[model samples]
Target: MSLRIAAAPPLIVPVEDLLRETGAAADEADIMRRILAEYRTTLLGDRHPLAEFRYRHMARKVVGVGSVGTRAWVILLTGRDDDDPLLQAKEAQESVLERFLEPSAHASHGERLVRGQRLMQASSDIFLGWQSIVWVDGRRRDFYLRQLQDGKGGLDPDVMTARGAALYARACGETLARAHSRSGDRVEIAGYLGSSSAFDDAITSFAEAYAEQNQRDFDALTAALDSGRLPRVPRTVEE
Candidate 1:
């Protein structure tokens, strides 16, 4: 059976307080409304579930790891009495991977991410879409929108036992296989990966050795820091 994620509890940020606080200096809530208006006929049609939901309010939002200092907002709309649906609109920037690789197909980085996720995953959020807004500085900014699901769970690999680790590895491998199959020729891939315990064993050996080397490197780095060879940089990434 598939898991059913619970809907998030309603967030009641009074519209009056929001507009008053954000009076004239960089209002993301107003920006969200403007962006959503363009998609009224396209995505949120007359018969859609969120069709009747108006953009009633907005609040500044902080996104997760590696995306620090990004401009983001949580938009809320109340339908009828207590029905409040929240959507997150996060600023999109060029992928660090793109710095080493070719540029994205979509001009907007947000659409590029959304398109890639759609191809790689079995399913995606229904509200997944992207738009560009002109900032006060005149430069345009791209943003992707989606509802934040309440049931999303995170992993803790350090706490897992041997059996749990093995299960997680198997599941992760299967997921990667599925994504590869969708993006490439499944028949050719199956043939290449065919009846192969040899390939699996080799890959497992390589991964374990690499992980051991990583541990050694980390230990060396700690020693260097203790000896004052390298100065620590600012917090560049967080998890």
Candidate 2:
């Protein structure tokens, strides 16, 4: 399918049009646009509300410190309503776990992640899909796009009582178990665990230590910046 890029920013246009922009070539965009349309069709079908909206604009967004420098974009879609749906497209990078384990089989890291996540979760973002883009530099980067904060926001931990906290923790454990069962050999895990809390205690201890290490690292970074060991751009943040 053919695609057209908007002449100016903040204008409504087909999202696949981004391929015709600075990132990818026209031919590549044609192929990718079809693929993206197929993905959308698979999730929401031909009559979904999101299918009709034009992508208004895209903006680069900052994510976690760990994900620093990762290419991420947010596209705002506009239709009949004033408050339109938003989608986030995040570039997939190599797994940090690659250091200890075999690399993933999928060529597109974004697809690899989405597949694993879909398998592990009871429900997933219906809009999720992987797109492989070739930049002007001729290097390929994989990205996965999903609806931003769809039906999100719940469980305010700060206000939870002790009973609520315990219930939440139990829920988390059950969810983790389900995810692990999908991702690994559940029978083997059961055999290894064998009604013992030994491994559980070990893992909990490790998690505590890891959290402490993260706090120390964060403190060190703050100290360095304060002492002029590091330089940073000045910005006021509202707490």
Give the alpha-carbon lDDT of every model: 0.74, 0.73
Q: Which ten residues in a row have the lowest lDDT in candidate 1?
A: 2-11
- TM-score for every candidate vs. truth? 0.69, 0.70
Give per-residue lDDT, candidate 1, residue 92.
88
Q: What clash pairs does model 2 have?
A: none
Summarize candidate 2's per-residue lDDT along 161-194 as a digit string, tens digits: 9999889878888989999999999999899988
Residue range 1-239, candidate 1, lDDT tens digits = 33322453223444345556546466656665677876443343356666667777666654557678787777777777655658887898999898899998888888887777778889877677778878655689898888855856657988999999899889889999899988889999888878969889899899999999999999999999889899754332223
Candidate 2 TM-score, C-alpha based: 0.70
Off by over 4 Å in 1: 1-30, 39-46, 81-83, 97-102, 154-159, 213-239
Q: Return the lDDT, model 1, position 4.
A: 25
